[model samples]
Target: MTTELLTPAEMADLVGVSVDTLRYYERERLISGVGRADNGHRRYDADDVAWIRVLRCLRDTGMTIDQLRHYCDLGEQGVTTKPERLAMLRDHRAKVEARRAEIDRALELIDHKIDIYLNEAAGDAP
Candidate 1:
């Protein structure tokens, strides 16, 4: 697919976020401005779209705004923050694992309820 330059709205649509959210991300410095058109409108490329996808992934993984901003700051400085970024990712992974455990417990409870219903229907339980 041709990765053409897109306007803010187009980029927002591609990334599945609102235009306001894209602007907020720009204000927060989570993503860099690609540049501006002659009419002073914001322009973005495929790389910007990819970066927004990363931002969304981080948000989905429960990284708070402060955490994202910190990560972005470190990223701006290049590879010097590799160790710190790894630490942050490890911490986020722990949180994801904990959430997964909670979901598994809930699924187990649901299965138990289903079993109870099935047993009752079979006249195996009063």
Candidate 2:
């Protein structure tokens, strides 16, 4: 199998995150097992990139740092942790679904007001 690796900047670009963020993740132990180049520069492999993408997704979806850390901790244990990870993801999914439902309600109200404004403009509203 061919192995792919990226420099810090390349990893950041590929992950759509800043280099500082990558360093921060490593420094904070949110990610681990990064390789070092001849010059001691950080090099990230495909696994690292994929992991960072997952981290970004979770963070973007409003997962708290402590929750994220817990998820990562469980993930570090490998397959035996699969069930725990599944449970955590399921819980997070429920929260996301609930938030989406709330947003849908707000959007429905906004659409209703827009309809009223349009009707009023067209003199269709009494």
Candidate 3:
């Protein structure tokens, strides 16, 4: 099925966020500002929807608003900012890896706690 051009509500529904949150992203300049209708209501195209998807993915991966703004600024600057953008991505990647390691440690701790509980229930202390 062909995707329809989305209104703010439709876009919010598609992206699984509130309309207010989408407006906040626009205010923060994280996503492209949607065009307006004759009545001044925002009209979002498929491109805007796609951009929100990418923004959501970045946010899910722990990219901060500041980072996203910086990336967006670099993107707006075109090829002249390519090197800086690459550096930013590389730094973010390192941070993500560190966070992943921390998560792994937390998972191990939870597993250890569960194992201890299981042992106690079994009358076999570990």
* lDDT per residue as tens, model 2, 1-126: 649779998998887989998888777778899999889998888888888899998888888778888888887888999999999999998998998999999999999999989989999656
Look at candidate 3 and tell me the lDDT of residue 77: 83
* lDDT (C-alpha) at residue 58 in model 2: 87
- Segments in model 3 whose C-alpha atoms lie over 4 Å from true places: 1-3, 124-126
- Return the TM-score for candidate 3, rounded to 2 decimals: 0.86
* Distance from true location, Cα of 59 in model 1, Å: 0.2
Clashing pairs in 3: none
Lowest lDDT 10-residue stretch of candidate 1: 1-10
> Against the hidden true structure, what lDDT does model 2 obtain?
0.88
Reference-based TM-score, model 1:
0.83
Q: After TM-score superposition, what is the CA distance of residue 84 in candidate 1 from its true location, in Å?
A: 0.8
- Tens-digit per-residue lDDT, 6-30, candidate 1: 9989988888999999889888888
lDDT of 2 at 8: 90
lDDT of each: 0.88, 0.88, 0.88
- For each candidate, give its TM-score against the true structure: 0.83, 0.86, 0.86
